[model samples]
Target: MADDGLITIGALARACGLTASALRFYDDCGLLVPVRVDGATGYRYYSEAQVDRGVMIRRLRGIGVPLEAVAEIVDGDGARAERLLDAHVAELAERARAAAVVTRMIKEEIRAGAVLSAAALAAAIEQVRSAAALDREMPILAGVLVESSADSVTVTATDRYRLSTRAMVPVRPSGAAWSVVVDAGELGGIGSWLRGLDEVSVWSADDALILAGGGTERRCGVIDEAYPDYRAMLAGLAPVRTRVVVARDALLAALEDRGAAPIVFLADESGLLLSRDGSACIAATITGPRTELAFSPTTLRPALVSAIGPEIMLDIASADAPVVVRSATDGDLTTLVMPTAIMNSKENDA
Candidate 1:
């Protein structure tokens, strides 16, 4: 009956420092259920692994978490659950503005004093911070997705018009394999805080993420909605019909120089063209077939800015297909620009 990796309901309650009545209430409410039950004896048994979840449930209830919200968190919808907690934290902050009430109390209980821990390189965080969708049309795009696999983590963002990604290996290798869509602003805060450090470690609770390092501990909310299938979008891309290499700085400068003019793009056998008001043109040398693609400058500039390298490859399949942008220096990075046509004249650009 002892140390068999399974325990009676009473033992589980005691193990998590909760009382029998409270556990029974939680079970009845459909929040946490025992792993096994002895129907004949009318007794329940819980798995040892569930101890952490039980403790989390107890702490959440103590803080006045609503029954529905608590179930959301317990059921692995932490992002949505975290948003509810954040509302509670905001109310608490207004009342106790100077105190670390939410930060200290919730972090300790959620972590159970064991240091909820995961690590990622600072370089990757910066990439995600920069790529966060600025346009608010798709609210969920406002966050960066941090996805972990057995050997790597990918940080990505998109704005429907443009997509950016950075993939890298984690430093500590915890194999926790957790994924979350975190607010772009929060991610930027993390990257800024970790600027001088080579690496950073973060811990996630059901409703919040505790960032700990450099004598600074802060809590931020997790995004609740499901992230878009950006990986699928990036996977089987259109064929590259015209792949031309140009200096990243040159292309960005060209895009930047178009002032007070209808932005236009003309890619031909000689070069890529950017012209404003038919006054002058900025040309990036190219060695591809003559291809005229018309799209707004706003749709493409982000990819050029993110490339940040000596050379950039603009992969184009047709006038209507998405164009792929790549940095010559970093192969692991990529940005895709969705093609669009102007209302007035696609012919004028060509």
Candidate 2:
């Protein structure tokens, strides 16, 4: 008997290239449920739409993925699915390393570079690389400055208006310090691939920056230009006269759909008010005196999105000074977003 447009379990198994028994097991586990069931005979029927999901489950299980992990990958969000696959791949690599494979020993070459967690490197790159300038005249500003020292690895990028810097402790730091400016677009494009590996080694070779991990290496040409003295700029920041702590997501959402217009932020004892003609009040913990600061919503929103935690702290020296945005809990990433003029005080920076 035809079960409307639904296919029987045997047909679904055949369509998805899985055995009927395996489909029954997945059905019993609730990972893949049939669209309809004939209660009289207890026969299950699945829609054609479920064929793709069935094939995905079969493929994932064929690679030795556990039933529970496979279920998550099949049912979870894209990020969760990717993370599960990455963890499984890492586990397989560990198994290969543990295997007693016979091999001849060769002299190992000690490459001058820092070894760090691939996911950490990817996150740091995401946090800072957005600040790189896309100007054609200054090609050097189009790349991110990556520096490795005896203790830590740091990535910094700036577009003259805003600057973002993040530092992380390397798993194995090089004995000597090295620096290279790698193209931001190229580095950012491989962030997903990098996150799949356990560890990555980064070093400069001649005119290119080499990132090697998991038996794979990606080489990107280095810009032969002197980067701005960002460290000195950091050291010369003015004393903070006002500090405000606010919910990161709420503030980010407020900036959405506001267009490219500049938004005014008024911080006082009451709380914080965001206004760009239309006003919205957000509860925030305010420190210091009442202050009004205006900033381009496009420029300021990215800094908030790149912030780590739920709460973010803003330290402002004055109305026209750069505002430092840092996570309330994590201090590894710091972003300085320059403020624009409010109204008739100075020229609009928006």
Give lDDT for model 1.
0.69
After superposing candidate 2 on the true structure, give the runs of residues whose Cα lies further than 4 Å from its correct spot. 1-110, 276-278, 344-350
How do the residues 1-350 of candidate 1 rate in per-residue lDDT, one tens digit apiece? 33556788888888888998888888898877887777788777888888998899888888877788788877867687778899877877686864577677765554432221233345555544565678677778898776755566677888777788877655544346667777787766565566655545555567665567667676767788899898788677776777777787776776676553445566765466664243444456665576666666766765676664689888888877778788767776777877776435554555
Task: Point to the candidate with the largest TM-score.
Answer: 2
On lDDT, the candidate that comes out on top is 2
Global lDDT of each model?
Answer: 0.69, 0.87
Measured by TM-score, how close is model 2 to the native structure? Answer: 0.67
**For every model shown, what is its TM-score relative to the native structure?**
0.59, 0.67
Local lDDT at 288 for model 2: 94
Looking at model 1, residue 252 earns an lDDT score of 70
